[model samples]
Target: MSTDRKPDIALHFAPRTRSFVALWLLEELGVPYTLESFDLRGGRPTTPEFRALNPLGKVPLVVDHGRPISETGAIALYLGDLYGAPEAVPAADDPDRPAYLRWMFFVGNVMEPSFCQKMFGWEVAPSTAGWGSYARMFEVLTSAVDGDGWLLGERFTLADVILGNYVRFGLQFGMLDADPRLERYAARVTARPSFARAMAIEERESARFPPAAA
Candidate 1:
């Protein structure tokens, strides 16, 4: 449901949150937008004004078309289909469309929660749990990467934006082991100019709100 007129896009963002994922996707879309960067450490999100946009008071909320869009996966899909350049979003009839959507959901649904489960040593049966087990999740992700590289074979779509960022974070935090193929895929996709742009923005914002003293 894209509007005919391009609405002003404002990213209500903060560093050290899921906000970076949206920033990377927006840069990859190559669209002109403004960053409403704020410091979560400063207690801005708890204000009534911010809570009006998201009751949960979260960052990385995108206000486009005069409406706020929360959740990283939703924001990526909306922006990808609406303004993504070089056809980063697949056509409705494309065979890879189903798989493309699946990967987008996988990042938030399976990847994040499973990583938390592994990190915390949560006890949950693979058969009953929605994400199964961390091992299975990792295996599934590994199998998704094909010989041609990228999730969708030859095309690099928004799926890469979502999945690539998560893998990059996993590698950085040592949550994931040294899987050569995953490492290569993360390097390849994130090496894009768009990712560089996102990183630059992230660096500037982080400096403004430096990590707390140890």
Candidate 2:
């Protein structure tokens, strides 16, 4: 959504964190913006002003024309709607919207929490837990994400940005059980120029804030 006036957008991001999702999204948006990159240890996110924008005190927050957008799914949807057209996001009434929204929410709602459940070795009844059990979560993933390649087939949407990045990270860090199709999918996601650009900026910021000597 281009305008005669360019939007004053800035991302309050921290390197080597979930902020990469927002960074990649911004790159995909192809809009001019500033990266308010900083290290988390600086106590910036915990500040009152920051918390006012996002009560969670998190990175990956986008200040778009003075309106703050937090949460990965919300960020993806908001930015996608603002800048995405003809591609990136499916139109509201489009047939793909339902599934697009499903997978988009699936990331933060099911996938990430399931990983946490795995990490903590927590056991909860399938019906009790919000993630509906880790194994069950994976089952749903295994079924939806197969041979078709893109979750929505030929269309790559914001859902791919959210879930695809998790799958890519899982593949990279050995966090996910081996699934050949997901492996191929991660390869496809990483191959995107937007992903590459985001990684490059991450590298530069990472070095710029290299860990302090012990």
Candidate 2 lDDT, tens digit per residue, 13-62? 88889999889988877888899999999999889999999999998899
Error of 1 at 41 (Å): 1.3
lDDT of 1 by residue, 128-161 (tens): 9889989999899877864557898878889998
**Cα lDDT over the full model 2:** 0.84
**lDDT at 150, model 1:** 81
C-alpha TM-scores of all predictions: 0.94, 0.93
Q: Look at candidate 2 and tell me the lDDT of residue 101.
A: 88
lDDT of 1 at 59: 76
Q: Single out the weakest 10-residue window by summed lDDT for candidate 1.
A: 1-10
The candidate maximizing lDDT is: 1
Best-performing candidate as measured by TM-score: 1
